[model samples]
Target: MKYDTIIIGAGMSGLAAGVRLAYYEKKVCILERHTTIGGLNSFYRLRDRNYDVGLHAVTNYAAPGTRTGPMAKLLKQLRLRWDDFDLSPQVCSSVVFPGHKIEFANNHGEFIEAVCAEFPQQADGFRKLVKHIEEFDELDLSQEAVSGRKVLGEFLSDRLLIDMLFCPLMFYGSAIPNDMDFSQFVIMYKSIFVQGFARPFAGVRQILRTLTRHYKQLGGELKLRQGVQEILTKNGKAVGVRLDDGTEIEADNVLSSAGIVETHRLCGTSLPTPEPAYGELSFNEVIFVLDRQPQDIGHNETIVFYNNTEDFIYAPPEAPIDTRSGIICSPNNFKYVDSQQLEEGFIRITALANPQYWMSIPDEEYYPAKQHWCDQMAAAAVEHIPDFRPHIVDTDIFTPRTIKKYTGHLNGAVYGAPHKILDGTTGVENLFICGTDQGFLGIVGSMLSGITIANNHLLR
Candidate 1:
């Protein structure tokens, strides 16, 4: 097969790339090893129930009539209407510590009010922080690097509040937990805080469907279950790709969303340089299918970012996750359905997990270890989430191994490689990188990365 561009992986980035190239009337082909789409942001069904995997909510929602943020531009470029996405704004989310709790409303003013209420002394500093973020441009790499801790320290003297502010941002966005770069911290803060979050009425599946339908309508070719074995290159430039079954498909250029390290491995020849550290962070996630509504069990919040410790450490613990620092998301709350109106509720809890630790466990001890952690996480969750123990009708657990198997990430690293910024260039001419590796954090960011590369690098 021959095409103008061949994109590997049918994730959001790959799909978005295909859509843009195809919209310009170019021949684009998207190949996926898995039968479904969305990569990490995909869904599955078990016993006639749908379970969403990759989203707590689509962060950084761009409301209708305002083509402002990244999400807005993406929809406008794709010719998709805002009505296509059924979105519900979150009621509120809280960051809780030992003696203090800060709840944030969807409105920016309300959120700022809540923050200022806790630390009135830093109120002026908080306004300055916003002004700085608004004026700062993360795309400008000429500026010196700044750490998130340093930025927070400049504004607030209270150490606990700094940790509290970063707890959710680190979990939701940061790959470098100990100290996330200030640029990344700024970008995440803009996306999550400035733009705010909203749940799609139909969940992630609807977003995938919209992208796939648009791509197909624009004459893009989508090949599922077709794995690319090698990226064919000659004279240090990408030419095409070879499928797992040895079928070679030629393209003018190749775009890979399989991640930087993973894509490098697909090159048959040994590059004359050392590869950067690939897999950095991974997560241990649990999905709980409750028998009753979330509000019925007294867990009324849509999402809560809670921690047991006064100081937050983003990395995985040496032992089990007993610290009780994690995100609790109630998917049902997105629709604003009351306890009496809702049927069942879905809650997903995520924790930073050591991929190496899980990989070293012997085959005989794997399931036992998983059971122990599951029990511990559930027990710890009850302290924050009401009726967590008794209301669990069913449960599903996914380890780093499972993530590796599905996503082809070396360590099941949630965010591909550390310090992977935009430009999508991977030192190999004509082969560009996108998705998490391109430095955009959430779902909207990934799609924007795809569009950025397609227009800036490819179409240019």
Candidate 2:
């Protein structure tokens, strides 16, 4: 059957587009390769516990104005409300240095005040740095503020502030501070600072479920397990798609949320080969799903404990288990809690891994490699929090191959493309793109990209 719009890749962007189109009473079909929706917003279950594959949290939901933020307005328009969960009010992500740790807050004034209270000697420096960040926030991305890295260098002259403020934030972008454009960085920073970052009540899966429900409610058709092999084009415009099973679905227009390279491949002769910048891939992540919650962790706060910059240790290196950069969050306290209490509780820990290190292994050996990394990460977590090991009830690991097999993302990059200058542009006519690669990495970026793409294409 012919449809007004056929969206490829049911990630957040695709879903957002479907929602908008359906709202307009346009006939739309959302074709997803996977059996489920949400793409990186997807989740998996190990026994009774569920782990979010991606989408840790999002910011900018609380901002006023209907069109201020994409997710907020979308939810409101869909008649959905943010499910209240036990979340921490601490806007500041806790950063642990060798001898000291810093807790960042949401309010700019309060955050600056806290920093000054913690390190009085650095007050002046910190205040100046905050002002610089505020100024950076005001820069327009649509204009000359094209490069993130250059703008950061110009704003932050102090070495300590650069390391303390920019390093952790850069981790979220998955790139160095200077490598990102000023406008992109400001969008990310504002999402966290102004919008307020918070996790869902059930998990990220809840958000996906809500989006899917809304999509269906709008009379959109979703076909799962139907891998699209190529775009069926007549002349120079996209007309439809050919599925892996040799079936064809026709449409007036196509929107892709698949990774850049895959989208280009699907377009076939309809669109030119996307330049190299559009197809660059990154490493995959290794995630561990714990059976029993670890002890000596917070149920209210998200703890990112790093022993040596690479890993967050709950135990020593020689211990039976160790983790590199353990991220712990409790399903209980969805809101803020006392740091002392959060330092000691039942929790889950995830170790961030370097994908390149596992490249030498054979495809069949990927699972074992993931297991080895999980064990090491678990051991490390036990060192920092001794009671961590005895509680392990279940574990599952994901490799690069696993990511490619499931989502068709180049390397299991949770965020598809690097947020760089050249990567954001799409050279195709009446064709647009969004997702992690198009410069929007996290939930906020994904949602914002939906609005950005729509504004560029439909609205304009």
Candidate 3:
């Protein structure tokens, strides 16, 4: 196929690039290895139930300004709207540590007040911290050098407060709170708390469907099951790509959302080898989706239970969220459910796994062990919600291997690269990287990274 731009990988980054290029009337072709669209945003089905394999919810979707947020603006630019979908308003995220529980609210003032209510001694420090985050202005997703740890450390002295506040956000960013750049942290905080957070009523896959529809509507050609084996470059320029089936497609420029390692492999001798970063091999959780919802679990937005910070901080240098001893739950709340299906309840329990540990397991033993891990996780969740075990009519578990096979990401990394404040920009010509790997995970950071890459390479 001959085109103006050839985009590799159908993930959000690749899709965003294709959408932008196509909207500008550029003949764009997106080649994806998967049979379906939405790389990490894709889902899997077990029986009649659908489970999200990658992304769950997004922040800043409910923000007041429609075209200001990254995803919202992209939809508008593509003449797409997600108004039809049912969206749940997440005003607070409840954090639980043994006997202690704190609710992080959406409103900045209210959030501070809530925190102060728990730890009154740290009230002044929390206020100053919020002030700093609110005052921060130079929020640029493009600039590679920004540390979140340094920014948070300035105002937060209590170690408990740091663990409570920065830990969850770090998981969302897929970067260590201490290592993250100040600017990125500011942008992330604004997107979540200042803007708003929301989840699609149907699930994450529905959002992907919406994006796919928009891409097709813009005259963008999508080639599914067409894996680009190599980037056919000649005379120091990206000419096109060679598919796995020996089919060669020519194009002016090749944009890869297949991740750093896969993109390098496809590029062959065209691009230099990308150096490994702290965030590349990070561990993500195996989300167990239960068929039945608990009856006693009271109304709560999202519950994060932390046993201790030791397992979280000392586990791996790059592990964003300590799932070994922690758990994040999306409980069954009447406010979040549709009126028709109120009886058919559902909930999600996520437990973080050690990537290295999973990697060490023998190939033949991997799948069975993964199932065992899911069982253990389900058991652990039952500890929190007693009625959870009986309500489970069906369950689905996804490991890093499943993520790697589906998305072509390195080590099944939930996000992409670790966002480092110091070495954010690696000198690669005509080649750019983004997504979780470039720092900033979750919906907001991923979309922001897409905007950064577009503004830097395309708009420039």
Candidate 4:
């Protein structure tokens, strides 16, 4: 069998690519290893409860009829209606240090005011920084790469304020957290702060469903529970793919949403052995099923970017899990529907962890390590959210190994292959790469990545 285009991985990027091509009436097929779609943004069921795995909160929000920002562009490009995503603005979120705390309101003015009030000495610098970010052209890859830390330093003298400003943005997007690229930092600031954060009424699965429905409506083929074993190439051009089941299917083009190294491996001898230079970061996430509403527990903040230590470190730690710096989100606080429809509210906590350490642990030590980290994180949460422990009705934990198994990301790299600008090329004609490895992060960014590759490579 042959297709006009064969897209590997049915993640956000692949799905968006499918929607774009199918919208153009191309015969496209999206292949996935998993039984379901959404990749890192996918969800799972736990007995009677349904938990969204990847999304703590959907960022980059744009209001209806406004049709601006990344989310607006995504919806407009995909021919999706504004009603497709029922988004509610976060009541409040914050970045907290030992002595200072900055609240982020959904409104741009309020957030700016909070920042200015907190750092009155650097208020002028902050305004100029935001102006620069607003004016920065995110698509201009020709712009040289500079360190995010360095850029912040140039504007603000306070290092902690820099870390505070970066806490949420970096966690959401940056792979090299300590020293993120200025381009990335600019894009993220615009996306998160300028555009703001909102929660989807039906959660992430709803967003996936919306994309899937649109693709199928456009007559695209979606193949789940099946994956490509190899890229069938001839004369240094990708002509087709062989399924894991030994079936050979041909295509004029192969667009891979798989990370760069993974896509390179599919190209046979054209590429060298995979040496992922971009240091990958993995995380340990635990979800707590709370018996009461977040507000009732004295946790009114919608999302909190926090750290126990005075300093911040973004890289994967080689030592035992610190649980020092991480994000805490209360889903119920932002749930769009009536609080009564939900039987219980939930709180999620995440911390950076060394994927290598988890991989090297003995089989006997696996559960022990997981338990140790789970307890450590729970204890750490009390420092930020005082009511974290008492409301816990049930708990679920996911480690690096779980991420690797579920997403097939190398070493459980959550954002995948770091931030290098690749031209979606593999020295193999008619083959391209997108998604995380393509330098776009977050749900909106990843979808845009697919649309980008489809428009630039497939359509052109």
Clashing pairs in model 4, backbone N/Cα/C closer than 3 A: none
Q: What is the lDDT of candidate 1?
A: 0.80
Winning candidate number (TM-score)? 4
The local lDDT score (0 to 100) that residue 122 gets in candidate 2 is 68
Q: Give lDDT tens digits, candidate 3, residues 1-460.
A: 5787787777766776677777777798989999987787777677766666655456665543455655576556545555733456653566665555676645666766878988888888778888877776645544656456555667767667666665555555544424456666666666665664566666676666766777788898999999989888777677788899999999876667666656666666555545455333445455544455544444255555454444245234333223445455562442364433334455555555566666566888877876676666666655555545555566566666677778877767675555432222333344455565555456555555555565567545
Predicted candidate 2: what Cα RMSD to the true structure? Answer: 5.3
lDDT of 4: 0.83
- Ranking of candidates on TM-score, top first: 4, 1, 3, 2
Instruction: Give the alpha carbon lDDT tens digit for every residue of 203-315 in model 4.
Output: 78888999999999999999997888899988778898998899899999999987887777767675544545644688899999988877777878788888767788888
Flag regions of model 4 displaced more than 4 Å.
272-278, 335-341
In terms of lDDT, the best-performing candidate is 4
Ten-residue region with minimum lDDT total, candidate 2: 311-320
Q: Write the per-residue lDDT of candidate 2 for residues 1-460, one digit (tens) a residue.
A: 8987777778877777777778778798888889887786678766765676664455554533335554566565455564422233433355554455556545556656765776677677656655766666342435553565555456455444444454345545543212455666666666664455566555666667777888799898888988888877776677788989999988777777786766776776566654444322232333433343332332234444343453222221232223434444343333534432322233445444344444346778766666776666666655544444554455556554566667887655554554332233445554556666556667656755654565456544
CA lDDT of 443 in candidate 3?
A: 56
Scored by CA lDDT, what does every candidate get?
A: 0.80, 0.57, 0.62, 0.83
Off by over 4 Å in 3: 63-72, 82-86, 141-147, 176-178, 272-274, 278-291, 295-299, 309-311, 314-324, 331-343, 419-429
TM-score, each model?
A: 0.95, 0.81, 0.87, 0.96
Winner on TM-score (2 vs 3): 3
- Residue 109 in model 1: shift from native, Å? 1.1
Which pairs of residues have clashing backbones in candidate 1? none
